[model samples]
Target: MDDGTRLGQADHAAGPRPPGVIFTMRYPSDVGFVWKTIALHRDLIARAFGGEARCILAYPQLSPTSAYQPRWSTAIQADFYDYSAENRQRLERVITDEAIRLVVFMSAQPADVDLGFLRGLGLRTVTSENNSYDHSLRQPFMKRLAKALIRRVLKRQVFDLHIANSQAQYDFLRGFAQLPASRLRAVRNGVDTDHFQPGERTGACSTLGLDPDRLWIMAASQARPEKRLERVLEVIRAVKDARPALPIGFFFVGEGENLAEWRQIALGLPDAETYRFFGRQNDLRPYYQAASVFIHGAFRESFGLVIAEAMASGLPVVATHAHGPAEIIAEGETGRLVGRDDWEGLGKAVIEYLDDAELRRTHGLAGRARCVALFSITRQAQEFADLLRPFLKDGAGAPY
Candidate 1:
């Protein structure tokens, strides 16, 4: 918990020089939860190599890329996504001409980056994710067979280290994926403490146009099926059915495939007028500050970053007691934990926070303190950089 002193004392630069080019993808600058993380730590990664960082972003689609993108200069057209011959050529040309060294894979998901090109780097490339998803259904028998043959494309030797944010990811990779624990390390995900602190509910409600008198709960993640939106709807439905007069507000932040369906469900709610869906927000501070509780029902979430953000904003959480949530939310300290697929249990927990101000305050305070102590990015990056110390010497970073 006392990670500040540890960060202050650790010699983060006591490691060896990097092998070469550092590769990563660009995320939209305004997607607060995920983008804010890179925006906060981009400099630390750059400084790790003394500004020798050469990164290639698959940024054809995103806008306002890399808010505080590092100070190093390289020679290449600031290209977009790599689906075409021209785009692929621009990327390959940059890699070949620059003699790129290492690749740094963040954001966990491999939706953007070129997995093959990074493998060709031959130096060391590492990837880190907040948590792991249940990709068991993603591959079929033929896909698995193909992956077994071409899986060399994803060989670990190319990536010297695969860092995870919580024990859930660590155990999944070790037990199911069969990755060596020595090659993978678990670190806590962080939050922007300065921005996401506890604030007066009055000011927040006034600014965000939320009713200060109503009991509001929020779930701030992409509205995907895996996020388990049905449970939230069911819980609110139960609470509203029993206590029809209860003034409650439900807010969903971010967007995804099930958004239209979720909106339909929201419209049928008893307090449909109070329900709010803010799509693809770049800033969630106001939402966190204004809400009474943050609830999550994801069947399999990676690390639950928004939970920490909410805690940092001094909001109580009521998350299901599953893999990722088990690690982030202490049973009674940060918020209540209920069973998954149990709408009654989740609803009762929601009602508990709604009615008890003292309980919410106690849990919210603990969450904020925990976030400040354990989930700070400075601590995460420092511990992670320690693991990369042994792999940096082969870097061939030429700025092409």
Candidate 2:
């Protein structure tokens, strides 16, 4: 890792003193919620600072077709996962060259990469703890224990501030991780309301080759076990079984380890032709716009960003009562929430919305309203800017 030139460098040297803030994350081929959230935040943080701060994306590597390809300001490619002294020296040079005053780990510092090294350089370090402990508990015992221990050590040792993406995540850090209240802050995820807002469904449906007459229910996320997409498939099966004549389709957008198996299972279900898996879509607006309802069946979600996007798209939601969804959906108002594993309840909720077009419209409008008011990208940017303000100021200091 050499002191490589920054990609898409902005002309910050000519204007008001703008503190450089680097957001570091793993830039893999598959675009997930974390990447999207960080990218959106980076752009918004730049705008919110009004020339008082410059935001940069620092990632190890990225796939050629990655949706997160940097479009503005500097994007530094470095070995963020490596903590060797040689790598640390290179990272330090990159930071010094960029004049970065603050560094935010998109999730936490990688297991091998220690934040203490960065903090020792007199740089403000913060960790946006995105994963939930409850979700980790679902993992195998040894893996769970290892993750818990690593996070505990990192949170207690080097990170200056810990930002939780949701109330649920905040609680987990407080109660489970046992971090002090002052060190933890809750900042819920936000969606780009302008991009995801309601639109005419016909064009999107036509482009996707979906029948305009059929009611489309969409789900988008990395297909993982905890996502419980199989449960959503069961709901779709039950609905199709009960109303054989009704034209309804289930369209999933995203690819993951379980996607192939899930797709196979979907093909085996009755009305298989109507269930489509569109893998790793670069643009999800079409799917959200084309659909009449959005369904999320994740067992535990720190924050369901897709749910907010769907709400912003004016689609009524039917999601499991996971901590994230429970906070986002106003029960029987914006959307319906069934128990995490309540297959029957999930089906019933979907059916109720499908059967009543007016009800769907009402909930959809309300959902969009809620998102615009609470979960807009601007609101999230403002919260983040406020948090980073102290660090950006001259002579500002951190607790660690």
Candidate 3:
């Protein structure tokens, strides 16, 4: 082996490097959680399995060129709609020249790259999120008929094989999308445990000049309207009515379209200090550690990655039994999950857990345990490698 270039199979005790390319748009640089998670875990895979991935990136015409930085390494980049004949030839050259083994399409990017071209190359297509028929398809007969005709011939190459974060989503794809069940694999999102855990004694609520002893309940989000913050407020209001002097506080994290309206609603709630807004924190672990409970009231989420972080931080979850949490948490075992659209049930579960200090600790501890056993960065890389194995090196095994 070259002295400077360490051998893949025997480099270090961390683990063997898996062979082949891994792909994602989430480079380490992006401020968002999705980007960071992909960035950090790729580092982990590179350490253990000697893996490399190519990213297929495109920028919107509105964005500046400065926004396009390669996530892992300098591999691939193209304009979102710059697929002219000359450009297509350049991309074709990239596909052949670099020997890219597979492609992972992040739903966040504007889809380009002409599906026929990708399919013609025989590149394995992978999508990270689920896709449902556009709600616009249900609008009217003529429109629906047109979309139905388009859907028949416009097959998405990315859908043939996908890695989902939840079982419900996996089922949604297989049952509704007509994909084979064998092709759909489940890869649950994981939290960066080192960064998120309980007893972060920063006195976050206190630092903000809020009461230190309040039993704070936070519904953390960027504050979108469809999130059903009204449900969260209704439940919190009812809970506070009974325990008039309870030191319970509800916090909103980050800013979004509905911030003003939600703030107005928060003002009407008990003590008004009962509701607080903390705009996006670059470091969110302390918030998870600070709260006695973490609640999510989103109507739709692919997976509430924050709930995983909250669980990792040892705060019991009181999330809607919506798509993601329903798949991640075993209700009554890990955290309390209530029916979707039921603020009364959501609030009741949260109040019940808060009142029983022992149960809170027990459930929180169980959640943390589940997080460690089931969702780790290492396990995430391994599962991903399992999916990639069939494609790597002679197609006999995944290179690990």
Candidate 4:
């Protein structure tokens, strides 16, 4: 009620039936990798567990800065209640009333609910990937110290199970949190293979009003500092200069604080007209479909969801060998992994694919195969369900 959300409607609709799992997170808004994963999770859980599964999502509020409006999928049963300290009583009451068996704190961000609160309620608890510790190492000491405290709390008291999205993240959680191997699980993120699969380029290029003749290299991400948009711009510039005769175009799709800054940088480049920026697109499939290749230069990511999406779209990728991308891209097979901040290396990698159409086709097909086998939403959700299954019945997987 504090956030102007109604819990009564969801409760009334489900009647007295228990929701097998309750997922609590910081935000519920659209247009983030986390929310996208949650959408897939909800769909998969319902399919996997059927009537026996009633998953309820709880979040504090919508993303204030997001360009897209908040919209929830019809399939997910959600409550938009405020989880501030002041609204703790309401949160507790709703969890109790819904008969939640498992309480999953989606991130390590301070929640409206706390571990002690859940433990006091005798609820089985989980804390999923908070952030990339590998990425944090590059931050200022104060920021890194703050993350350390959060990691300590998560390791010592908060969760019965800690799920990391990558092996690098798992190592960080295991060592930093001092969590036992039994208490932690590494689960990679997934993409909707069907929706993201490859399509004919001509139609997509026409829909977006782009020339199909030029070789299109696309990057879709918010213009955040950690995303290294500056590095991406530099790579494209270097590649263009090195191969002046090559007809190439780069499209950037997404919005953020650094968009104008990046746009300005792109404009001053040699072939400024070739760079197109689409601010905050709802459907990224067209961008992916029309691209000859996808490139990402983020310094770090817990899981490279965009890279996976690009691969699912059957586009070969050139990404930094950061925490997430290093694991996702099968170097020399699906895509190439350049060192972080290595703009020249990244440029060369992109050029290699652009110069050879046969190599691009082979790698794109390989990337698609890899995504179908390892990163499908259905497979991801089923893995999540397996982790959650033992706890729903009894105290088997409950906290110690």
- The global C-alpha lDDT for each of the candidates, from Candidate 1 onward, is 0.66, 0.79, 0.62, 0.75
Q: Rank the candidates by lDDT, best first.
A: 2, 4, 1, 3
lDDT of candidate 2 over 1-400, digit per residue (tens): 2344354345545655467888776665346454666677777777777767777777676545556554444566666667888888778777776688998877773354576677677788877877744644444667646555555554454367888888888887766565656667989888888988888999989999999999998999888888988878988999988878889999999888999989999989977999998887767888898999999998888888889989999999999888998989999999999987898999999999989999999999999999999888788878987887888888786643
Deviation in Å, model 2, residue 22 alpha carbon = 0.7
lDDT of 3 at 206: 59
For candidate 3, lDDT tens digit of each residue in 102-144?
6565542225446667657655556666332221122456754
TM-score for each predicted model, relative to the true structure: 0.80, 0.89, 0.75, 0.85
TM-score-wise, the better of 2 and 4 is: 2
Tens digits of per-residue lDDT for model 1 on 1-400? 0311011214225554223444354444334556656545544544454533433333323344433344432212333234366666665555554455555667444445555655564545667765447734344677545544433344433245678778777877655555555456787677678788888887887887788887778888877888888668888777767666678788888888999899898898766888888887767888898888999988887788788899999888998766777777878888888876666788888888877889889899999998889887667756765655555544433211
Better of 3 and 4 by TM-score: 4
Q: Best TM-score goes to which candidate?
A: 2
Q: Which parts of model 1 have CA positions greater than 4 angstroms off?
A: 1-23, 26-32, 47-58, 61-85, 96-99, 107-116, 119-121, 135-158, 243-245, 394-400
On the 0 to 100 scale, the lDDT of residue 353 in model 1 is 85
Candidate 2 residue 361 C-alpha distance from true site, Å? 0.4
Task: Please rank every candidate by TM-score, starting with the best.
Answer: 2, 4, 1, 3
**Model 2, residue 365: what's the lDDT?**
99
